[model samples]
Target chain A: MELRINGLKKYYRTGKEKEVKAVDGVSLEIGKGELVSVNGPSGCGKTTLLLISGGLMNPDHGEVFLGEKNLYRISPDVRDRERVTKVGFVFQQFYLVPYINILENVLIPTIGLNSYSASVEQRARDLIDHFNLSDRIDHKPGELSTGERQRVALARALINRPSVLFADEPTGNLDDYNAEVVLKYISEFAADGGAVLLVTHDKRISRQAHRSVRMKDGRFVGDDTNPVK
Target chain B: MSLINKPGKRISIWMIIKNELVYKKFGFITGVLSLVIATSGFVGAMILLRGDTLATEQLFMEKERELRAEMLQLEDDYRIIMRNMGYNVLILNETQSISELEKEGYASTYLDYEDVWKIAESGMTTLNHLLPVLQEKIYWPEKGMEILLSGIRGQVPVYSKPAHLTDDDQYRSPIMERVPEGKADLGSEVAVPLNLRPGDIFTIRGEEFEVNRVYSRRGTRDDLSVWIPLDKAQSILNRPGKINGILALECVCSTEELGQVAREVKEVLPHAQVFEFSSLIAARADVRQRAAKLHEEILQAEMAHQMELRREKERLASVLIILLITGASVWIFVLILNNVRERKHEIGILRAIGFSRLKVLQIFLGKSALMGVVAGIIGCMTGALAGVLWSGTGLSFSGQGSLVTPPVIITGLILAPLLALTAGLLPSVLAANQDPADIIGER
Candidate 1:
């Protein structure tokens, strides 16, 4: 699978009179099984780029293509439908519903999906076991550590086994040890032929990606093809 | 997951119900209260009205019976008075030529005296003779009179002595034996027997007659007067053929039809003064008017009472309806608002999970509707129990012990919940349509 964003522009209104460009005429492409990181300082539109790429936001002037389908060409409803089955998202805040248990959290995406089956429990069990969360499957997010919670979120993001994964500051809230563990899972996901668009401020996690890009003031600043030595 | 998915996609009613139960229990309680209020008010009014209706019917029936009885008595009295008046006219005409000496002379002399006696008694006898015919003529039966006289010698009974002074010399008059003291005080021309002590006498037509008996009047007309035989009356009047008026008292027919019967009698006997029993009683008009006024007043009062009861019932029902609707709406609104606040995150999460804005709204609203339906059923049962308890006090006019037995109460119960559901809709929809992205982004 390949993902492409062309001539993406996003603007924000401040007060009633002021307008600021959050993303300005930026474009990029990622191939199948590639792990790419979009690195930027705070408020640099890294997360915005990821959100737009995942079809969560409408760009003022842009087009995003996943495989051969124009993501923005279809209606928002159709785009949401496609995104549910074809793309996965992980947020910096974990976005794990505090009330639900880990297994229930993982099973959220399959709730109303036509292809969902009773065997989803077994699939969820498998994912929980793989993430070393079997003992904590019944525990709520409040009961889980930061690493456990992030793992559960990641498990939920990959529950439908989407072809492309977008992670926005996935390690932004984790300690060093849990951050390393999270990066390892993301790398494993990329190696297994899933495309990843990762946004992060942490250089240590960005170094693990095959391609790294830097952004500043709503513009791409650098692209490093070489992995960090 | 597949079974759950199928139902979830189609809008899960059970999920909606569960969510409402979890969130809006207080609204449910208020909805039940509303049903109770409405049902109690409506049914209570009906019960009171029914009781008043029954009482009114009873009073009307009683008044009708009394009026009917009074009219019948009046007719009976009218017939009696008319017959008596006719007899008096005949006696007066027959006795006009009789002198006192001749009347006494005729009594002494041995003669049949039948023609004179017949003439003297003709008026009364004529009525007696015509009674059977009149009985058939009128709708009611006529009354007949019988009279008899006997003389006593000392304590032994004897015939009156003729002035011939033959074998019956010891015979005494019946009047002397029966007359008590004070017969002389009535005057000397009143014939007291020579062998007896003097007593009071009463004059009839300027001639005195001894009083024999003093008793209260026993007929429908309570009159006080001297009773004298036909011959004596003729002698006192000095017209040997004349007698006092013959009275015919009647005891049949209802008073209600008396006026019509009296009118009919007047048409038949125009010369006689014909009057019913009610006409003789001076207080009759006053009594009747008073009774009529009382009846009218009672009817008016009862009508006013019923109107008041109806107005009160309506007022109560109106108040109850207003309170029920207001209370239910307020309660439902508050409950839904609180529920929305509590479930804001759930709504946000569902929206994020690809549940459409419409779907989320349906879920919330459906839950509230389900709760309303359940509360309505409970309210009906509660109202029914309350009606039973209240009816035991005899306060209810419906005469029904059960709330559900009254159609109005049942209707109220049904409508109250429907109102609650309507009240809950707007808040639920607003809560559901709130933007999930904004909510999620808040944290």
Candidate 2:
């Protein structure tokens, strides 16, 4: 699916005395099946831009469009429904529901998709196997290594086969080998006709995407088509 | 699976119950305790109320029996007095007339003095002659005379004597031969002598009687005299062909036929006073006014006391039940609330996983409801067993009566759990209304 973010802006009020413009007048678009990365220093509005694109946070101004439906024009409940069906979100912390098993965690999005679907379980099993986590399906997040936990979170995001996946620092907590594994998974998801928008501070992870943009002070400062250089 | 065919709500309820089983022991215990207290209170109240009702009924019945016995004894006393006085008693006042006596070939009797003196001087043979003539006109059976005579004998003194002449050439009396020398003498006034005291020898002249025993005539100037048998009086007075005036005593009648007998006796002896046995007893005992007033007072007092006790008991039971229910509810609510508070992280996860606020509420409430129902049932069963074991065995605090088992205790047990659930509703709803986004954000 084509994703468009137009003139997005966000601000945070600090104790009623100061205002911080996290994302200011920034816009970008991604074609179907394309993987794009937003790279910046910490507190440079990269995460804010990703959050707005994934519908996890509302922008103070501007609009987000997935194909023909404008996300901001609809009620929050409707937007949430659309987001659950069409968008997948991965956070920097993995944010895995701690008490549930890995398989159950991966199956969370499918539960929202339909109350009862036999195929959803099979889909979850296949995702676990794809991520090489079949042996740890019943293990809780606390028992899993950081890399395995991130993999489980990715499986959870992809359970509904969301048209667009948004990842914010998908490998920020992992070692080089685990980060490569996570990056490979994101590239494979993009190759399988799913569009991806990733935000990261790591140049190596950013280079894996088809295109890259650099943001500074809530505005895009650079656009590079050849991200590998 | 088809969404509608799946038991989504039921499954949620099961999950709620399962969660409660895992996390809410204190809430479960409090609910059970509430059921126990409610059931026990209900059973105790039932026993007390039933016992009081039964005792009051018994008291009324016992009082009724005593009143009946006393009334029967009073009637017997009046009957004996009539017999002792040698009179035929009648109940109706207008049955006989002086003209009827004259037409029946007897001397007309009057309430005036002349006829009274003549009859007193009359002999027994003459009285016997009058009896036959009276019988022909009276058309009454001998049983009527027996009844009449029995009533007269009931009124007379137990002992009597004949009047005779003394050697002093003055009148001689069995009771007192002559008046005291300095005192005003009542020469020939008639008197009745009694040998018994109150509550003594109850029979006179072959019939039962009750003697008042004290004989002080109010405003009377008369001779002290003795009561003599009719035959002995006739012989001593030397008046064999005449009779003294007939005295009539009164008695009660349970049937109309007896009253008719009294009326017939009046028709035969016009000067005789006819009295109904019921009216005579009423008058003699002064029972109509006094008994009615006393009964009214007693009934009012009893009813008022019963009502007051019932109200007090209701107030006490209500307060106790309310306090028990409220205390149980508050404790259970607090426990459940604490449980919810501890499960805040779980709640955040569930919300993140797309569980609605309302569903979260349902799960928590469902747990409490299940506990309430189970505990209530247990309480009811225990209460019923206690009632059965203690029924009719006089396990009670009030000295008036014994306790009875009540069905309401079982009903209370059944309702206690529901009440507990209802009590938990507010807290559960509040917990459910908590924003999932905010909870997760806090974390």
True contacts kept of each: 0.03, 0.05
Error of 2 at A209 (Å): 3.3
- Candidate 1 vs. truth: CA RMSD? 12.5
TM-score of chain B of 1: 0.51
> What would the TM-scores of all predictions be?
0.63, 0.61
DockQ of 2: 0.13
lDDT by residue for model 2 (B205-271), tens? 3333333333345333222322233333233334343342334333333323345544544444455
Fraction of true interface contacts that also occur in model 1? 0.03
DockQ for model 1 equals 0.13
Best by lDDT: 2
Question: Least accurate stretch of 10 residues (summed lDDT) in model 1 chain B?
Answer: B131-140
Q: Rate the local accuracy (lDDT) of all candidates.
A: 0.58, 0.60
